[model samples]
Target: MDINNTLTIDGAIKEFAPQIEKTSPLGWSWITFLSVLVLFGFYGLYTQIAEGHIVTGMRDNVVWGIYIVNFIFFMGVSYAGALISGTLHLFRSEWRKPVIRMAEWITIISLLIGPLYILLCIGRLDKLHNIALFGRIQSPITWDVIAISTDIVGCIIFLYMALLRDFAHLRDYPELKVPKWKKKLYYYFALKYHDTPEQRKKLNRTVDIMAAMVIAIAIIVYSVLAWIFSVTLQPGWHSTIFGPYFVIAAVYSGTAVLIVSMYLFRKVYKLEHVITELHFKNMGIILLVLGAFFGYFTFSEYLTKWYGSQKNDELLISILFDKYYWEFVISNYIGVLLPLIIIGIPKFRTIKSITFTSLVVILALWLNRYLIVVPTLESPYLPIQDSRSAWVDYGGTWVEWSLTLGGIAGFLLLFTLASKLVPIVQLSALVKKDKSEENRKSE
Candidate 1:
């Protein structure tokens, strides 16, 4: 397959360059809306910092409140970036070309925002640096700090490497009508990339190596986060399966996230040809498999406890199934069942339906995490002998809710800006993948 037959370098520029060169009023409005949410989040942060932790609903019994939930959720969702891009690239899947760049961007943005929740959870922000200075080697917190730092660096390097060829393409292509400043920006990041045969071979090898490392690091980092919870004597979390369980759940939710993103970008950019029905169907199948697996993990986790009937474990299960009955049913039963049914049915596998299913899965997974954290804390092995009603009730306060909204808004804002800076789709990779596929079919 000739390069021109699969994808003319200039033709790709003609098609995708305008995406970066042009801006819509709707884009501005969306950015403005996200900015408002960020401002509100900042106000909530200020109030919490000024008023102290007392303003929030957290108490001695439920010391870990919504902030911890946000931390876990953000960290978990961040897995979508590396796991999707790294896995798809390693597998040499051609369909991944249209979406991998966006996936990598999500990884960088989510990783940056994930740690902010930890900052929010800390009572004393001024002493945050001291953790690195005097952190004990024995503490899981220290391990988490190291893992997160390492993963972020790895993600950034991998993303930059992926972007190099694309950046060079944008820099050299004149038909894109790119402004002078943008051309210079591209030129700077492109690093004199001239698409030489030697350069291409070197870059491909580098990307292949980085993709493998990212996949390994992604699995290890999330498992480390899970260990922080499981290592404790907490009844619900103390299990041998928590590590793989967290990794699976992350992939499950992260894939759902990637589906949602693909839908939005495809629809908005009028990229019906670039991201097609086949992409959605393939991703839907992946989602279906993960949903079933997650269901199995859920059943196994609780079933083990139910059979043993340990008093504390039973109490925690009761809190989950009895007290939080609706949440339990919704997240586990409805959440799992709906996706399976919709995806399993060929008639219902439309882009809109798949996107709808992703929204449900994302929200339900967040609720699942909430159930995991709060219920365990509520039913400590030693009963809450306290007389105070506040000690028993652990509903999150308005400040926490506001900050949560802010986090969501901040994530979207970063994504929006990044999209404008670079073509969300990797034209370079798409062309190369298409050429390879064409060659294979001919052979």
Candidate 2:
């Protein structure tokens, strides 16, 4: 058996590309499903905008609710794609090469969805313009918009530049069997890429510069989210350590998402060998380390509050321990503890086990987020003396649920569609063998 045939980038790309061309029942089913979900999400968003945020749980005091939390979580998850890709690419890790494209796009697409959701939650779309006009440079929300946008732009540039080589291959190669427009795209991007001594040097330098910028910008963006909560004067949120705490949690969840996405893509595209059991095992270890760190942060955040015994802290901590204790315990156990233990064990560290563990961690992270947003506002410093007590801790309504589901589906759908467009995995090294040869000749 030719391992090269099974393991090669050309082979995987060739096979995966046909997934788009498939006109069969299941292929149509995915198209139909994605379309319906997106439409439903879009309609829900429109209705939401029409009715205003008042229909949702958000109110005067608790202006930032699930939407903001979701924004932060999505941004963090994108970081998995951005930072992990950037770090691995920078270090020249071979394991990262096959997956970096996936990582980079996930960051870009999720970053886009995250901001839209924030806008949706913000209700009045008209005032968004006012943000720029009166937008205080010092505001965390303004900083968030700027940082996330900059990071998204950086990720896109990095992704497009990296994929340029593969596009060149599709343009030049015989087997690609592509259309005129696609051929045009290949030729178009190929212009920036000649395998000359000068061009190769320029390409390498550009990739390095963009990769470095992505890392710096991603870090700043993560810090921007941390500042969202820390900049506030709330007890659990006000700690100096809050910024780093939020960043760690973001990475922990973001990495879990990448694991889940990678696992899904392997199955969906049947690129099992390319994705491999080893990738799962290695990433599982990464998650295990992150879970441990998350556990530490969780312990520290709660412990300091309970120990300090300030009046508000005391109220919130007691309520958390006693009243909201169930959500508290379950989120920790399934999200953090299970993954940590399962991944830590040699026996359970297989691909299937890791995938299952990753789902648990991701779910827990979602629950963890909901708990954080709802409980803090529920236990505000002032007591809720109102007939509409339930409104105080606004659980997500169906519209919110539909919108959120639609957004998540949209992210996954983008992956599926994106896989069909460019080299889902970069193949420039093989296709560009000619370029490399030309560069050598020029040298």
Candidate 3:
């Protein structure tokens, strides 16, 4: 077998750039609709930020609202695109060629929006900025700020570097008729790839350096965020496994997010040829592995709490299994278990079915996130100090709902616009001078 024939994950993702805009129009309208909604979400967010966090449901105790959850989720999701895309690229995963562009772009855009949630939560621009100007070195919050900022820079650079070859293709192909601004962006992004023997060597070396940087940034960002929780005195949040647990959970949720994205892209862009059943099937395998990993973490977490016989842990556990068992168990089983079984089946391996399962699993995971986050705040010590008249429920008010939907809509909108503006798949690099069989395979 040829040495290059074996293929690794990153090598596969390199294929995406050339074919990005080549697909049919499947997702355009939906993405357009969501883009408009994102505009609305931002409008609302702007007003809320101006008015203050008082406009939302978050009281003193419930400072961590849905926005925080979404923020963390977004940050976690960013990890998948950053680490998965860049990490695989560093090692050269052949199957990763098609997906890495989406993953990388997804991370860049996701990280950009993530900070907004925290800003909204704080609702004080002056106070937030003060932290930067006079931020304490020792605070986890400070570390989080530094970590995410560094991550954002790294993601943008890594994504731009990955786009280089694709930009060259767009420049070469007249049929694409890529606009002037886009061409300009592509030119800069391409960073003058002459594809010379020495230049190619330097390009590869540069990509390697960026890959390492991206991976380190992803790790540091997530670890710092986890520290934000573990540093707190909270019962469930404080744990040693919280670091890797956060990373694994981030990848798990992030993959589900990518699947949601894939479904939309396949539908909107009509990339049915590029994004095949094999893609979803491979993602299912990843989700299942993470599912198992999450399961073990959950088991160990609960077992330790049970063994320690902590009152706070028992109280929280009792509240969960006894009262919120319906959503809780359903979310876990359907989100975690059902996908594993579906993917394991030979007949269910088709893309259509796998896509369906991915949606189900994704929805279940969303509910699971709600269960994981909201319940803890609800079951706080001292019986939720909120008066009976106050909003103590683990849900968003109308404003929160509008705003949350708006945030989600914004994410979709950015994704849609980016895919349209540039080749979402990174087509140029993936077109092999030879090894045509390398295309369409999943990592």
Give the top-scoring candidate (TM-score).
Answer: 1
Better candidate number, 1 or 3, judged by lDDT: 1
CA RMSD for every model? 3.9, 2.9, 5.4
The positional error of residue 317 in candidate 2, measured at the CA in angstroms, is 2.3
TM-score of each model, paired residue for residue: 0.94, 0.91, 0.86
Candidate 1 global lDDT? 0.86
Which residue segments of model 1 deviate by more than 4 Å?
1-5, 178-180, 384-387, 432-443
Candidate 3: which stretches are off by over 4 Å? 1-28, 382-394, 434-443
Tens-digit lDDT track of model 1 for 1-443: 22222675656777777678887898889999999999999999999999999888888788888888888887777776798899999998977888888889889988998899888878888999999899997988899999999999999999999999889878766666767888889999999887667888999999999999999999999999999988999899998889888888888888888889899888878788888888899999999999999999988998998998999999898888788999999888877998899998999999989989989999888888888898898888776765476786699898999999999999999988888888888878766444432343366
Candidate 1 local Cα displacement, residue 380, angstroms: 1.3
The residue pairs in collision within model 1 are none
Question: Weakest 10 consecutive residues, lDDT, candidate 2?
Answer: 1-10
lDDT of each: 0.86, 0.74, 0.71
Off by over 4 Å in 2: 1-24, 383-387, 429-443
lDDT of 2 by residue, 1-443 (tens): 21222333444446555643344576568867987898888887877877877666676446567676677778888876778888887897766665777778888888888887778766557778998889899899899878877888888888877877676556555566556776777788777565557876888899888988887788778888888877876766777776666667777887888888788777776767567777788788888988998888888878888888898888777767787787778777667789877898898788888888888887777767766666677667666566365566566766777788788888877877777677566665323234333544477
TM-score of candidate 3 versus the correct structure, residues matched by position:
0.86
lDDT, candidate 1, at 324: 93
